[model samples]
Target chain A: MTLELVVTLIIAAAMFGTGIYGALSQTNLVMIMMGIELILAAALLNLVAFWRYLHPDAIEAQMFVLIVMTVMAVEMAVGFAVAITRFRSRGSVEMEEAQELKG
Target chain B: MSVQVIFLLAFGLAAVWFGIVVFRTHSMVRSALALLFSQTAVGAMFLVMQAEFLGVLQIMMMATEMSIMAIFMVMFMMDPGGLGEMDMKHQRKLSLWAGIIAFGGASGLALFGDWGPIATQIPDAGEQVRLLGIELLGRSMLIFESAGLTILTAMIAATSIAVQPPHRPKETPDKSKEPYQVHNHGGAA
Candidate 1:
């Protein structure tokens, strides 16, 4: 409930909102992934803020942050790999034409 | 406000601004780089908040990750340079409304929620790092190992997916058979 904590939380929330907008609005697969990255970044910001302001002695929060970072790296790798495969097969990475799974 | 709070606000603003820039730019490469700057600003905020190890790790990891992302942006994007001036988004009004609602809801929660007691005493950077290391190796060892395994699996899967299959040679027609061989055993000729 400190000023700093509130400010940090608000900033995280703003990033989260922006991320949602980008992810939902972008037509490209990579752009959507970028939005997801921003969302994850916002989560990381919140985690670190909570650890610093509420439970400074709990180091588990830091470990959680590291795991989240690893997730981000893994996500980027897998997403780009999928993008490359899609590009090779379809000649473009736009998501609008990816309707093979439509039921 | 304390110096730490001032620095925190400054970095926070930078992060938010660059994050907005990520979606606002037309060029894919610029968007990627803007995301990088935004994440770096978040790391700087971590530093301002006195989480030195996490801050350093964030900056270093994001630097390399975002560079690779930028390269991929150039490779996969149809208009990486923004020369085409194509609109890259869809459902703009819906997204805008969703974003506004999300921001308002989250801001309300942050402002009105009761976050109990704040801890004023924080460990120094070195001590925090040591404690984090111990936590990772001690109680959270299983989680750490699982994450490592997951990353390894993801790497292998990505590499396999990205690799092209070998091209097979075309089969040649067999020439051993007699051409137009017709057996006529009738007595008439």
Candidate 2:
């Protein structure tokens, strides 16, 4: 059981690392959102692992997971909407070219 | 190793691998699909952990969300197919260092941290779900309701932001022509 938790945590850490790379390095708005999605997934994985291994009886952990999932969904929605608006206005969603909002 | 551990490792590896793929791929569509697969693998991990409802919810939600993201990629990307061999990254060195540091720190914590005694007895799947439901509707009712409201607001905000504003016709004054004389309607009446 301890081994499983460690493995899961390590995996989640790897994912979190990859997401950090993606979110920080990606140029496009959609790609950035994808990175954010992965990060949130990592958080969810950690939450579930803890709930299962450490506090199996605590339903509140599950509730927290659901809330995180909702946050992920809402974030994606708002992100895509912003991407759409950016594309409509500038004809490109590249972050490098978004100097208009730099101030 | 128990069957559960094996399954957990498998799904965990799949999730990490596909998460890497999401960034390695140049094609926007491929990236989106890779993210979908990664999230699905995470869902499978949830199932391996015996959180049935969460696993199903993760899979279902990610499927729809990533499909929409794929569609958006096609619509918004200049080269969705990645045929141009364009590099889509910035601050590569910094990001690499950040990623490595984050992984090292998190893994070190996981490996060294003393997480108290592991719970050996988990409720059955059905009971777990029932208790989760009760918790959601009971003590967590406020949080649940807040989340719902936030989603509704996000939906509305997204729609409004995405919708094109009505174009009002520009009133071009015909300066070349004489202005029309407006007769007093009251005097005429």
Candidate 3:
């Protein structure tokens, strides 16, 4: 296998591991956010790697990624806004506490 | 060794990592994060398959969406400060059985899957862009422009709704004003 593929594989592996660890181990909301960010970074890395290696001609995917980035920015802003309102209503961000009505 | 073997190895390792993360983490946020990572690695596989457009979209959509969701959950959940211990609820036998079933199913699928032929000609990013523009907006400039306008309008609306004055009503100037007075009555003994 080429070195590029090797490195890409390694990175992908590390990303998956980190994502799993973050998802399984931490209960804090912010830590979970960090874990999500790490996973996203890993996925982006995969995209760039594949773009460089496979489709040297296709620019469509790159543009799509850009659009996705814009969408993500909007989503993050909206999400944070919603979160702020929720925090105002309730004083905590713990997931366990949210199980007040699990009928 | 063949490139296919290497790629397969990467996929396997990444998948295993994803499984481990999903199994180990108790928080929903962490699980989402693990899902994001797993999705991204799949995006890379898309690239390898010569689907550049799909690959990029996968990363952008999956990663960004997951991040936003995580943040939203963090902020809007019962605790804003994340200052409390979480109760980990486990139905022990169910969890173990679920894990076994998932692992077995995944392994079975992986072992039997048939990947199609490797794409011979992968287009460049620029060529793909040109094709996409033409395909999406062929003789339809007005529609595209209108879509852009709609987006602008949405942006304005969202901003107006999200941005608010940072002071409480009581903190602002009090509208009502009256003279303070104390009434006293003398009692005869």
Candidate 4:
């Protein structure tokens, strides 16, 4: 592997680590969502890196990335809507206290 | 190192730094912005990798997403202004160790893993984009349509769930005691 690709992969690894830290440690639901976003970004970096460096001619990776991006967007939308609903009903988005699933 | 490589290194480091800052900051809005900065740096790294379409989409999409995200932070988070100094985290030591272990595993694999052959002949940028378009509209069309339909269903579900009243009949009795009476500020403040 080239130095640049290796560096990109390392960056992905770092971003993943930070994201896991945030997602696990944060009690705030929004902060956890931000952590998940970082994880998705890291995944995207890996996909783009692999495609650019290893199989540039295949072209299918681009579509895969696009689909992944679409999925991310949809996930954020549903997630935040749930957050808003939770805030309106329970007046809180803290994951620790949101134990009751029926709401 | 070439100039491109230098730029890549600079952007990569910035991305990782901001990713760390996202969790370290006390303010929720600031944390979202830090995430935005980190994601933007990743987009720049994509540009450094010479993937223009993906890079541009990353910057634009993340800009929109994170902006809306800041609004949510202000709406839902307690003491988002950071005046209360309420700790927003839990399980700090355990999570730190988890993160460190994850990094160790990833780095070890990245360094030691046997990645197969690298393609030596990459098509020109324009040619690559053209092929990508054909690939998307051809073999990937069914996948795209399915994803589009799924997104449509999700949007309808989310809107219905979020826009409708929080409390309605058929909800469990204990929860509906004070119908529609929501405790403001997370029931903590």
Best candidate (score: lDDT): 2
Q: Which 10 successive residues of model 3 chain B have the least lDDT summed?
A: B110-119
Comparing candidate 2 with candidate 4, which one achieves the higher TM-score? 2
Model 4 alpha-carbon drift over 4 Å, by segment: A101-103, B80-84, B166-189
- Most TM-score-accurate candidate: 2
Q: Which 10-residue window in model 2 chain B sums to the lowest lDDT? A: B77-86
True contacts kept of each: 0.77, 0.85, 0.06, 0.70
Q: With candidate 1 superimposed using the best TM-score fit, by how many Å does residue B88's alpha carbon deviate from the native? A: 1.1
Candidate 3 docking category?
A: incorrect
Ranking by DockQ: 2, 1, 4, 3
Output the better candidate (1/4) by lDDT: 1
- Candidate 1's DockQ: 0.68
Q: Against the true structure, whose DockQ is highest?
A: 2
Q: In candidate 3, what are the lDDT values of residues A3-103, reduced to their tens digit?
A: 44445545554654454355334444444444444545455555554555555455444544444444444544443554354344555444445576345
- What is the model-wide C-alpha lDDT for candidate 1? 0.89
Model 1 earns a TM-score of 0.90
Off by over 4 Å in 3: A1-82, A100-103, B11-43, B53-103, B106-126, B138-189
By TM-score, the candidates rank as 2, 1, 4, 3
RMSD of 2: 11.3
What TM-score do all the candidates reach, one by one?
Answer: 0.90, 0.90, 0.44, 0.87
DockQ metric for all predictions = 0.68, 0.75, 0.13, 0.63
- Candidate 4 per-residue lDDT over residues A1-103, each given as its tens digit: 3766677788888888888988899988888888888888888998988898888876888788888888888888889888878887888988988888636
Cα-lDDT of candidate 4 = 0.83
